[model samples]
Target: MVTLPIEFRTPLTEGDVGALGVLERDGIRFEIDSGRLILIAPRTLWHADACHRVANLRPYAYGRQGMRISRTTVRCPDVMVLFAEPDPDASCHDPADVAIVVEVVSPDTAVEDRVVKPRIYAGAGIPEYWIVDRHPTDPRDASVEHFKLGVSGAYQRIGQAALSELEKTG
Candidate 1:
């Protein structure tokens, strides 16, 4: 198994890191920032039902696929709507083709989900980013915060929804 803190002689792109077999390892993800590689450890298993629900709402939407935020950075969103089907063997997706990126917040991931990821997604030019926060008393229920990237290149709060209250469209 590839261990943590593996050093690279040269800066590698997101595809190169994926080829090293770590991103395939359950839940592990990394980001290359300013030529520096940073590996983020996987959190314990946590899946939101809302993520799956959102995935099925539109065509070409997928769950947990890594998205290429830049030449050197890749981030996996909980759910993403890729307006078109990608090549079958593609390792990651380009943000240019992405319509929306969703993050399902777990107890331990609040800060990253609510702040860090939205900033990254916005910077990458993702048009929309949503945060699904599970209801305190009901695991099956969730609150979704929808953010739209505006003309200024920053995300603006566009709307909100309760999963339990959403009418089924599909």
Candidate 2:
């Protein structure tokens, strides 16, 4: 098991989160409430494979691999779908430019992926968020929970389907 501990202790504003370097594990999930940096999770083979698959699906043009989708938001999701062409050299993106953010779940990141990330994405006005469900034991079958942000500023579960289904449809 590989562990990369982040040593950042400075109190940072929301926009400052973009300055943190992206790491192997999506890196850090900054605590906006308490202003603390927490290591996201260790990178696993399953997680890495799922990330590529989700990011490269149907709409390949808008996909971004390892970059922050929101300069004002804290957490960096696994993959992001930008409405506009992604700036190749840009480290952090504007929330208005991002349409969908995808997080591929693993054993270590399941809790954060389901709860914390959705909250951060919704608050940032991200139009959509997807949780690519992966189990620790059996990495073969991955399902997705598709969410769309509502007028009330919360993500509503719009659909659920297997990863294979999305690949097939796309």
Tens digits of per-residue lDDT, candidate 2, 1-170, equal 43434444555445544445444336434333345555554557867777778877835323334334333235456788878776677745667777888988777778888998788779878889999976434558678899999999999999998877788888
lDDT per model vs. reference: 0.75, 0.67
Candidate 1 local lDDT, 26-136, one digit each (tens): 455665654566665554343545777777767888876778877766777878898799887875788999999988887777898888888888988999998888766
Worst 10 residues of 1 by lDDT: 40-49
Q: What are the models' TM-scores?
A: 0.80, 0.75
Quote the lDDT for 104 in model 2.
Answer: 82
Candidate 2 residues lying further than 4 Å off, grouped into runs, are 1-9, 13-34, 58-73, 135-138
Q: How accurate is candidate 2 locally (lDDT)?
A: 0.67
